[model samples]
Target chain A: MSASDDIWILGISMTKFGKHADRDVVDLGAEAITAALADAGITMNDVGVFAAGNLMGSAGIAQQLQKQIGQTGIPAYNVSNACATGATALRTAIMAVKAGETDIGLACGVEKLAGAGLLGAGGQEKSVGHEWTPSGRYGAVGPIDGRIGTEAMPGVFAQIGMEYLHDHQYGGTAFELFARISEKNHSHSTLNPLAAYSKAMPLEQIMNDIMIAYPNTRPMCSANCDGASAAVVVSGEKLRTLSLEQQRRAVKVSASILTSDPFEQACQVLPNINTLTRNAAEQAYEQAGVGPDDLDLVELHDCFATAELVHYDNLMLCEEGGAVDFFESGAPWRDGRMPVNVSGGLQSKGHPVSATGIANIWEVCQHVRGEGGPRQIEGAKVGLAHVIGLGSACGVHILEKSGLAA
Target chain B: MSTATTIPFVDYLVLEPEPHLIAHECTGCGARYFDRRNACAGCFATEFRDVDVASDGIVRSFTIVTFAAPGVEVPFVAALVDCDGTSVRGNIVNCPPDPEHVTLGMAVRLTTVAVGADDNGVQAVNYGFEPR
Candidate 1:
């Protein structure tokens, strides 16, 4: 196998994604990293590099983690790419292994938002700073702009939902479809032990919930929490040297692609769907030599109910304006064809920003290894994980059961 | 006696009572940007010219924001307006921020309003798209 094809994910682990008032970001990160190491049947001594992701933390986080896990004098990188930090870190590890730079590499993502003074009361922190304006390096429109008055995240997505509904011909009302998406994810969360909300919410309750924004109630939005997730990747040669049991459980990293948005003058006004996500997903599918039809499941960034609906089309899983039908066909359910977000996604799984991307990978790895207990897609062999950040970066990774190909 | 002073909220907003937004237009590709551009992203041209964006446009998408940062009032319409051939993001004012009042394709005109006043009695001015 080529070096690119030789990269394999040996283990994955994540903390229960929710408001961990008692834990620091570092503690959450260490717990996940330690769990991942144990799952890989290895120790920190065996890890050649550590790539850590955090958005609202100080620098030297990777070094801090290294100190806690016993400093091995290995090079550690601290990655920050808004919400896609985890996936960016994971891609760094994949590159390291693909380039023969390391036999074993670790990628980790951690975030602590609760009581971090990040969101401040009234959700005013949602406003975009002047530095993020069109003149900035990460030039992309934000959910809220201070000069334009505080339009929070829910409001931003609500606009997209309304426009999408008006522009498309759907069998159901936009509100109903949004509620359905929320209800579906909540139902899927019931089976995920690590999910923050495991109880199935009725469609009525979701629709009737307190409206944070027009057409978007509180239930339609992802919760801000504290959590971490980590994964260990190794070269294919290293995988072959492992025990038969380990080899049997290994998952191959078929593709890891990341893309950023091109400079656009009118990003928000031009259909709220993410162009970067489509670009990244296309590259990932090509790199993996697999199409959307061949995948067993997907774990996408569902930051809001409308986001999930928009992504169904952006990922090319269905035709444009066909997401409502796709959901109505029961295709996105756990047992349905091409199940999505069996982990409840960010909606019910809890979105701790940086941790979210790694959490998606953890869920996909579980499915690929046939380890997803009640939520498993039976006979699942191939899966996709996708995440997008607002500073506007998108990451897509495809994984297949080891020994299934090549 | 206190005298009222006015200042632009952002450098891009022209402070005339009947104000209009300005954009940096690329000489090569005609791509317009709200902020100053060092280079054109469309045609990679180093030359640009300041152009006045048309004040009238239709609402492409809108939302009523009920939650916001401190000091900003709730239930305001945040909209993306298509002005002439370019798209601009701003708040839709002079109308109730609700589904009944803020509909798609609503015609809006660009106008300036006071955002806040400093301790020195200087009124900070910001621009928005109002019902035409």
Candidate 2:
């Protein structure tokens, strides 16, 4: 693609990921969008299109946000793809700009999930106290999630982690290995001031915390919090018309790819999380004309420590069946060869559902622009941001400092 | 004095004379599914036929859940059993939910459990696996 056809992220911002009891969905959305607009030195009137994503809120979130921010009367899109909702929303804006439909596009994601305990399996909302009638799909026993098997995120990811170890023949210390991964992410959180829980958790603490599942503990899971993230995207050609300062700080959108589960018999019921992510990674690398080795940093969906271990393989950061060895080598630590989740990841940075995807990208964008504060990876150039939602959607975005940019 | 009619929790579960699972096997790709699927996930074939899943299987993967949402009991063994190449997700019962009792590749058999009953004397039955 020509430089004129390329899409670039001109500005990005994310709210401190934590409990915001006084804030509602629109409040957070407006805050993120306004800040991102100011970051790019632009206003809502400059945006040709708007996209917004939210999980628990009603439809037309983009329209609602416009009422609070500024109603430019541009085409507004509301997107949701489980946890990848934010990335999907951002992609909508990028696609619009790439298609010449817009010169500047705005995207934002927001969510408020404070005090919302163990997130339920999406799709199965067991009727609470509703009299069990003998006429439905299950006859009388509702969709068996907790009763028989587990559709719960913790149990599912725990099983996914164990299955990877069992499949790879990593035994004996498999549980401890997972705990160590959590410890690394929690430690990384200490450098990230915006993280929800920036405390460094000892390995023993993570292992001894309330065991949500066999291999995963409470500390190893993503913190349920509220926050928002937004970004402004512009066509590369249009970006040249902006101020030199804005043009110099713009991050090139090297690639953006989304994938869903392909038919796999073994994990049909559980939904294969690996293949989709690998597919997205492959596509992203090919699109960016770069390999995993080129990434200076990454912010992947570490909803659970178990999920993070498998993603190392899924993201191709390690060779096939090399995830265990990769961790043992400490390559994923912040100072390691390939630092993964330098911003504490979802475990401590907090996962606000729809906001997580863009927040991850924001983390990468910050480092690429040499503005990552204390957690910055020195001279970081290329970065990858990834998020996977259990409806089986995976989004991978590769970003880099444009050659023409500072 | 009341009469209780026991019903299988899910339609695919059979409890008459013996406990077994019925899978919706795709005619095109031979893929099996415990729940009713409109089309085959593998080949997208709209044809399906019921096939009896083996009552005996080996535990492929298992997790001992120790924490759960309110009102739901924890410390249970949730396992994915592979029966004759068909994957069945269910709980492991009649044994402790720990490493000593439940293990990967352990032999198990299908068993039925009475979940609960309603005011009209209707008992709901769910399926689980037990160490053989």
Candidate 3:
């Protein structure tokens, strides 16, 4: 869809993710909000709406967060869409800007899951009803939870990989290339002080590590994390009024699209997922009047390393099945045409459910603002962020240098 | 899987006759959904008839978990099965499934096995997967 030219991302902040037994969830949020306000050189009074993306946080949690942060009378609404909670909040903020609600709004996502003692997501999840009547004999499709866990989840990836393998006759490298990709992210995590798994291992070690799912090792699985993150988004017109350096640091959200997988698109979809990813990219490019060839860096969801390869095809960074070619050529790096995951990724940064999508935007914001100290991609002009939520939903957003830059 | 005919949750909520998974074949939109939906999320069809599902499916994706919690079992498999042109996930059980014979497109049937513990020393049964 068309994004309004008025809304721009001014500043973003996130608490270092990991189990902080000492800090309460509200405390974590308070810390991030303070950091965000300071980062944007703004105060709570500038925030018109308190939009919170909290998936697992208890009810009335936003009230508690605001109380802890010293009572902002702004309206706070809680948003949840499983793991995509944060992005949903971001979406709301963008919608608010487009609707002429407020010039500046706060989009914050925080979850205090670590100390809450929940390990895996959905183990204790409330089972929403799926409408059905027992159909024919015992020869049909199974139900949910039947196809999860050990052999099941891996079975899906391995099957898809094996199919790809059978089709391309490429196996060993698929796993190896994926491992290298995972290892690179893991290594990149060390640079991110907020990332959970900072200690990186060699590809040899990752290859030898205990397998979690077939063709996937434990390292490939995103770590369960607990953290809080916040961002201050303002209208582009307002951002231009800020200091020249601040304007240079502002990142503009171009096109943000959320779509589900349509089966008819499957035939053409898998073969041309690159087209699909590029389809969204093209929309963002068109809305922002930028092109895929213009993006300097990206933060594609690397929940699993293999996903990134699929994404390369989907994002139209290369032709379908040409990810292998890009990997071997060492392109899409810091110096490559498009640097990816300059802030590590869910693979290495630790996927904190609600905070992940917002954290991704936070990373892109830092990259364009030149705050990513060591891992910074020089001359980074535009950034793209994409995340796929379950229920087969996907959202992609594009951001370019805001008005406040050096 | 219990032959009990009634599906219950937590020994408290009794889902009478147990909601069996049925798909709605939309003539208007040509979209199908497992279990009934108010309207196809894809196609808003208010009219839908229940098509009883076959309990069999091909294991599309599978995983083996070795992480054993304090009171939990390990080496169990979780998988996604495709049958009737759709996929769903559940724990894979029955014949000691060899990871090798398990192909992505391997065929299997749905087995409703007791998962958690029950009133007696018996385990509470629900739906899962077993080798076809």
DockQ of each: 0.41, 0.52, 0.18
Candidate RMSDs in Å, in order, are 4.3, 2.5, 6.4
Ordered from best to worst DockQ, the candidate numbers read 2, 1, 3
Residue-level lDDT of model 2, residues A1-406, one tens digit each, is: 2334588999899999999999899999999998999998899999999999999878889999999999978999999899999999999898888888889999999999888877864334445454345545445356566677886788888888877876887766767998999999999999998899999999998988898888888999899999999999999898888888998899999998889998888877655789999999999999999999999998889999999999999999999999999989999999999999999999999999999989999999999999999999999999999999887899999999866645
**True lDDT of residue A181, candidate 1:** 92
lDDT of 1 by residue, A233-338 (tens): 9898888888887788888888898988776667633433467888888988998899999999999988889788888888888877787788889999988887
**Ten residues in sequence with the least summed lDDT for candidate 1 chain B:** B1-10
Which candidate leads the pack in DockQ? 2
Residue A57 C-alpha lDDT in model 1? 80
> How good is model 1 by TM-score?
0.90
Q: Stretches of candidate 3 above 4 Å error?
A: A1-4, A70-72, A115-170, A173-177, A260-282, A332-335, A403-406, B1-24, B49-59, B68-73, B81-99, B105-132
Cα deviation at B10, candidate 3, in Å, is 16
DockQ of 3: 0.18
Cα miss at A260, model 1 (Å)? Answer: 0.3
